[model samples]
Target: MGIDTFKEKCGYEIDEMWLPRVTAITSILNKPNLYRYFADSPNYPAAQRRLDSAAEWGTLTHEVVERMLKGEIVKPDAKIIPSIKAFQKWRENNIMRISDPEKDVERLVVDTKHMFAGTLDVVAEVNGTRGVIDLKTSTGIWEEHYLQTAAYLSAYNKTARLKEKCTTRWILRIDQYEECLGCKAKRRGKEGVLRVTGGKRICNHQWSEKKGVVEFKELEGYKEDIKAFLAAKELWEWYNKKFIRRIPNYAKN
Candidate 1:
């Protein structure tokens, strides 16, 4: 897709909240010579194909972002053009700016060994304090979104070269564009809300690092739930690397 098309249609910007997982997964999946480990597995070919597709998608997405930020207009390929147009209309109506678009930032850091690391999309000063901002394209918000943001914060605390602490993290939801015809109703609707199809709110979140907490104002038990999620992610990673890697020929069954 064209970068301008994606940015204008999506109507949101990337943030630090997405860095941790993206960084971690990208690092693991893109690790130098790491695919060799899967060479003997039955799923190697399919896995490699999937990985290749993912890499292409990642590269395309990055290119789109760069083009958009540079104020260049991009033309999407035929397959994605219709959707892109629809998204453009939706974003034009509901686009919300979470921070100043004019800021100089550094690149994101991704680390694999620590089971956490990734580059954040945007890090800027919010009200005189540094904060992380993430952009997401989804039909609706998921609970894990908060955990993902928190994980990014944790990673930033560990590896960001900046001397200042990232005291805030945010998730900005860019609703998918929905198009319908033959009715008096609006032809296009919000993407994020369209996913829920209910009265649920789809907006942005600001997580405070100093408080040592992340909050989802819409959900009552958000804080406790996030803590549990982080713990589970840690355990799952450990099991996959330390335990699952040791299993022999179990996949052949």
Candidate 2:
């Protein structure tokens, strides 16, 4: 997308200067799994529609999760209650303490040095260690998540006080799925399609009730991850050079 589109879709402008969004930059990376998904789908339009629907669902979950983090009383949409319940269960079992939900939730971070920006989900102290906590509603955590969170952690720490600097990052994935009783297979009905994995194919599977699942993983080697993110940013810049060059406020370097 062009600069105008970034302003509308991503809102990454700082002081009238357009900077590429972290997610937009990361989108430049080749995703083999996504390619396989498209290859396995019926057609391009059908695959894209599923992806779009998944994005909408993710957005809803993000909004609701942010509200819950802020301690706001929320009546979650019926579509996402299972996921929300899973998140709540995780919250109850963990020691993640958001010091100030108002400032910590959905906080926007900018990397002036790198000329990119993104909104981080949460900055909190988990089990006495402070870090960035990114929320996801995907079926599984992928390698690209490391690059995205590394970018957020670097950008956030650049301007944060020493006490507030995040030393690590975590991906908090909340999802709801069913399990096949006979075959021990997991089935997900998100993304506008049903996907089954890890079970005997020929078995007449008795599916379990829909339940939430939460996975929390701490990312390591962020120093290298940030380097990778910058490289991705450079490649993204090259891809959008024509549009980027027209934006007067964007840093030229």
Candidate 3:
């Protein structure tokens, strides 16, 4: 997870692409706080806990989806069962075929040209259109997601040579209402449900849109997006001193 590991695996030291994590760059740049559902609450700790819980659930969702896509049996907990089922239903309904569900599916890639590294979620084709797709449990897709995807695509293109390189890109978002924090937040306002249990507020929530899949083609100007993402990478490096050379005293004359 550190630069040393990257160096050992990538067979290189920190050059142009030291270890500038792609997600970190997009997050540091102008990424919006999509988890601002409880910003207005006086109980900041509870709000933070809520955010933490959602993040943990998101990770679980990713695991479930990954297992299912790889043709592995999944036995998710009771809480995340609904979201898992929803994703299963979507994949079944959409007739998704596992394009490349290999162990290297989610790979940590270093784009030496661009000076960034990140693990891409999925590289596969859905419904016969080949592309790089990222799974999301978030409420909605954001510009930052595209920026992140652009970085992944850049790395994929540079490292791996495929018979037919993926020119199509997509953000496949699968989520259920009960697992969504924002949806639960709305229940307190719209439904006036103040029901509390086991030191937690339980409200009647329902899914608005169970599943959403967006196809982002290279024709959508991914070349331009890559340029912008690299610019942000430079900004992040300069600000964080990632590109600075300290000149170790032992090496220095």
Q: List, residue by residue over 155-247, the lDDT tens digit for candidate 2.
A: 899889888998899999998889998989998777788888889989998999998889999999998999999998888888877877777
What residue runs in model 3 are displaced by over 4 Å at the alpha carbon?
1-17, 34-38, 178-219, 242-253
Rank by TM-score, highest first.
2, 3, 1
**Per-residue lDDT of model 3, residues 1-253, tens digit only:** 4644534442333443345567777866654553353554447776676666667767877887787778889788766665677666666677555555784467666675655678888877667766677877665677887788888888877876775366767787764442343343321111112212122255454433332333333336697888888888767656645323431211100
**Each prediction's whole-model lDDT (CA):** 0.42, 0.87, 0.61
Better of 1 and 2 by lDDT: 2
Deviating ranges (above 4 Å) for candidate 2 = 1-3, 6-11
C-alpha-based local distance difference test score of model 2: 0.87
**RMSD to true structure for each model, in Å:** 15.0, 1.6, 7.2
* Candidate 2 TM-score, true structure as reference: 0.94
Q: Against the true structure, what is each candidate's TM-score?
A: 0.43, 0.94, 0.72
State the weakest 10-residue window (summed lDDT) of model 3: 188-197
Q: Using alpha carbons, what is the TM-score of model 3?
A: 0.72
Candidate 1 local lDDT, 137-231, one digit each (tens): 33335556555555556556565556655766765433222322222122112211111122224333222111111121222344564465556
